[model samples]
Target: MTNKPTALPARPHFSSGPCAKRPGWTPQQLATESLGRSHRSKLGKARLQHAITLTREILGVPDTHRIAIVPASDTGAYEMAMWTMLGARPVTALAWESFGEGWVTDAVKQLKLNPTVITAPYGELPDLAAIDFGHDVLFTANGTTSGVRVPDYDWVPEAREGLTFADATSAVFAQPVDWAKCDVLTYSWQKVLGGEGGHGMLILGPRAVERLESYTSAWPLPKIFRLVAKGKLTEGVFAGETINTPSMLAVEDYIDALEWAQSIGGLTALMARADANAAALDAWVRRTPWVEHLAKNAASRSNTSVCLVLPGLAEDKVKAIVSLLEKEKAAYDIGAYRDAPPGLRIWCGATVDTADVLALTGWLDWAYAQVTAA
Candidate 1:
C-alpha cells in the first residue's frame, strides 16, 4: 500500500450523514451538569431551550415559527407533520429521488391519505406547474440520494390554499431557505450540523401551527408524534420541553455546532463555504470524464450531497472500486445509494473544507484511472 491516506484527523469523519463536525469542535463545550439530569428538570430544560433558540437564530427562522427539539431524528419530524396535516385533504407529492419517494409512499400508503404523486426520473425534479397547492403538498427540499435540489422557492405556488411541508434535512445550513414558502420544515442534527443522531428539529410556521391545532385526525397521535392538543398549540414542547426524554449528549453536540456556526459569522458565511466547496468539485466534475453529476440541471443541483454517476463502468466494478477507496482511506461512504445507479456521493456541505474537496477530487482522478486500467 502506497501510504495509508492521511487519516481524517482523529475525527475526520466524512460520512454523508453523521458527517464530519465543524472546525474547533470540542466535547468541553457541552455542559456536563445537564448530561445525567432529567430533561424536565430546570437545568435540563434551560439547556434544551437555549439549543432551540440558538439554532433558530443561526438559521434565521422567523419569530412566528415554533421550533421543537423532538425525540426522533429527521424521520420523526416528517412523520409528525404528516400525521398532523395530511388527512385534511388530497396531497400532491413531488418525488424526484429516494427520500422524496419515501415521503410520497408514506402519504399514499402509510398515512392512508388521498394523494397525487408527480414523479421525475432519479436525476430530475417534477414539473412545478403540476403542483396543486389547493391540496396539502409534501416535498423534499434536497434529495439527499440524488444530489438534486429545488433551485429556488419561486416555483412554489404563492397563491395556494393548502399547506406545504418540506423536508430540508440535507439542505439546511448548507443553503438558504425561504421560511415564507414552507408551512412545515424539518431537519436533523446529524446533517449539516454534524451532531450525534437522535434529535429532530421541527420548525412550524404559524400556518402549520394553526393546522395542528384546528385539524382533527382520524388516527391516534403517537406520544412521540403529537404536535397539538385540545385545539391549542403545544407551546411547551417547542420550548425545549419535549413530550419525551431526549439525548442530552446529542443536544449538547448540536449546541456546539450552532455556536461554531455563529462564531464563523452565522448562516451567510456558512452558505458561502458550502457553495464554494461544491463549486470546487463542480469545476473538477466538469473537466473529468469518468464521473458526471447525476443531477440533470445545474441550477437544480444540491451543494450538500453532490452525487456522481460513473458512466460505462460495470456496477459490480464500481462497488469494488468504492471498497478499495474506503480501504485506502482516500474516500469513504462515496458509494451511490442502493436504489441509485452506481456512482459516488460526496458531501460538500459547509463543515467540509474546499481544500479537502479539491484533494478528494485529485484522489478521485487517480482512482478512476487505476480502476479503469484494471
Candidate 2:
C-alpha cells in the first residue's frame, strides 16, 4: 500500500452497494425503542407505512400506483415482475448491459416468453424501432455496467397498448423517471439511497395492477413473489409490509436515508449533487488523453455509474492502476466489471461529494504516470 496521509473525512465509504450514507446522517434517527417488535404489529406497520408514503412523495409516483418492499434485492423484484407480467403478450426486451442481458435470457430460455431481443454494444443503444405497442416492453433505465442511460422516455411511443416494465435500479435518485411511461418499475435501496440491501422496491401502475389481477400465471407463484391474494391485488404490501419477515434494522436504515434525502432538499438537491459529480469527472476526462469515456455520447452517459476506458493501456495495466488507487486509499472499488473491457467504473451518485471525485481523479493522473513510467 502506498504511504499516504490518512486523515479521514467526517465520512468516506464508496462501496458500490451499501455506500456511504449521506453527509450528516446518524444512527440516532432510528427507533431503537421499537427494535424488538413484530414487523406485522401495529407499530411496525405504521413505521413501514410512513416510509412507503414518503417514498411515493419523493419519487413523484401517482396516487393510483402502489409501492411495495419485496423479498430479495433488485434482482428478486425484477424476477417477480418478469414471472408475473411476462408471457401475457409478445415482449420486447432491450438490453445494453449485463443485467439487461440476464433478463433477456430468462425471458427466452427460462420462462419461454416469446420475445424479440434488441441489443446494442457497450457504448451504443439499439434501434428504438420495431417496438410494437401490442407487446410488453422491458428495459433498464440506466445501464449500470456500461454507465450509459437512455436520454429520456421519448423512445417509448405515446400510444401503447401493452405495459412498460423498467428496471431503474441505479437510476432512481440521480435520473428523472416519468412514472407515466412505465407500468412496472423496480429498484433497490443500496444504489442511490445508500441503504443496506435486503429488500427491493416495486412500483405498479394501474395497468400493471390490472394485469396482476386478471392474468393467470402458467407457473405457480411463490408466497414471497405473489402480488395478488384471493384474486385481488394486495395494494397494502407496497407500504413497507413484506410477504415475509424483513430486517427492521435495514428498514430503519432505509428510513434514515430517506429522511436525510428530504432534509437535504429532496430530489432536486440529490440530482444536482449527481450532476456536479459527473461534470467534475467529465472535465477531468476531457483534459486527460490517456483515458476516455466508455459511452460515445455525452448526453447518454450516466451520472451514477460513470465508466471510462484507457486508450492504449493493456488490460493488466488498467487493472494495476485500479489496484494502486485502492491500495493508496485514493479510491475504492473503481475497477471495471469483468465482462466489460479494461477501464474504470466510478460511482458518481448523490452520496458522493464532487470534491472527493476531483481528488480521486487527481490521484488517477499521478497513479497512471508512475505505472506507465515503470
Candidate 3:
C-alpha cells in the first residue's frame, strides 16, 4: 500500500474561476480610498480609469483598442458584445466545452440569429481551417473546462470581413494573444488575475467599434448591454464611466492584481509563471500510470485550468479521490468541472507557485492509491 504523503501544498486553492490570489496577497493590500464612494465620484472614476490604463500597459494592448469595465464578470462582457453586435452579419459559433455551448445557445435560441454552429467533443478543438471568416466568429480562447486551448492565433486570418469575438476569460494573462486577429475580446477579473468577482473587462478593436457605430441589433438591448448611444460608441464607458454601478472593493482588488503583474516584469513574466506551473504538473502526469491529460493534443493543452482523467476508473471512484483530497486538506477545489468528464482539474495560473503544484502531486498519488484500493 502507498503511504500517505507527509508534505502538503502550502496553499491549496485550485479553483479555476476566482482562482488562487497572487502570491502574498491580502485584503489589507488593496487600496481603500475608492471604497464607500460613489462610482461616479472623481476618486472612483480615476481609480477605474487607472485600472484600464494598467491593463493596457501590462497586456500591451494597442491604443487602437478600447477597454472597459462591464457587469456580471466574463459572461456579461461576452453577452453584451453578442447582444449588441452579432446580428450585423452571418455568425459562426464554435464549441468544445460548456461555456462555448452557452454562447451557441445564445446565438441560436436567444438572439435567433440562426448562426452556423461548429463543435468538437470535450478534449478536442473544432477544425480552425473550416471556419468561414466572412461571418462573425465566436470562440473561447481557452476551454477552461476541458483543458484545451488554441496553440496560437496563426490560423485566424489577418484580413477578414467579419468580427472575431473571443471569450478569453481564462487565457488573458497566461496565454499569448495576437491582438490584431481579434476584434472583440472579453475577460473577467476573477479568472487568471485571481481577483474578486462580479466585474468584467471588454476590449474592442477598431473593427468592433466600427461595427457598433454602423450596425444596430434588431432586438432591444438591456440598459446594461448598451455600449453605443446616438449611433456612436459610448466613449465615457471606455474611459472609466461604467454603464452600471461597480464594486469599488472589487475594482481595487483587480488593480492590485494588475500592479502585481507589472511588478513581476509584466506579461512575459506572467506567462512564464503559468508555463512553469503547468510544466511541473505535466511532468507528474507523464510519470503517473493511472492519469492522462484530457486534452490529447499537447499543443492545444491549456496552461491554466489543466484537466486530467483517470483511465478506466469509474466516475464514482474519481469523485472519491476528490473527496479524499479535500478531506485531508491536501488540495481544494481541484475536482473536474461538473459538466466535464469525471476526473481532476488543477489550476496552474500565474498566481500559483510551482512548488505547491509539485507538492500536490504526492498527495494525488496517495489519494489515488487510497480510492482505487477500495
TM-score of each: 0.96, 0.95, 0.99
The clash numbers for all candidates, in the given order, read 0, 2, 0
Which of the two, 1 or 3, has more lDDT? 3
User: After aligning candidate 1 to the native by TM-score, how far in Å is the CA of 175 from where it should be?
Assistant: 1.3
* CA deviation > 4 Å runs, candidate 3: none
Order the candidate numbers by TM-score, best to worst.
3, 1, 2
Q: Which TM-score value belongs to model 2?
A: 0.95
Q: How many clashes in candidate 3? A: 0
- Which scores better on TM-score, 1 or 3? 3
lDDT of 2 by residue, 1-374 (tens): 33333443223355556566776667786766458999888988887887787798788889988898888989889999999888788899999888899999999998988699999999777787767878999999998888889889987876788999999988998899988888999999988888888888899999999999999889887888888888898766876677889888888888888888888888898899999989999999999899999998988999988899998898888889888877777777888887777789888889888878777776788778878877
User: Could you give candidate 1's per-residue lDDT for residues 1-374 as a string of tens digits?
Assistant: 22323433233245788777887677776768888899899999999999999988999999988899987889999988898787887889889888888998888788888688899988888898888889888899999998889999998766778999999999999878989998999999999878899889899988887788778889887888876777888789989899888998888888888888999999998899889989999999899877788997999999999888988899877887778777767677888888876788888888888777877776676666667778
lDDT (0 to 1) per candidate: 0.85, 0.84, 0.95
True-vs-predicted CA distance for residue 66, candidate 3, Å: 0.1
- Between prediction 2 and prediction 3, the one with superior TM-score is 3
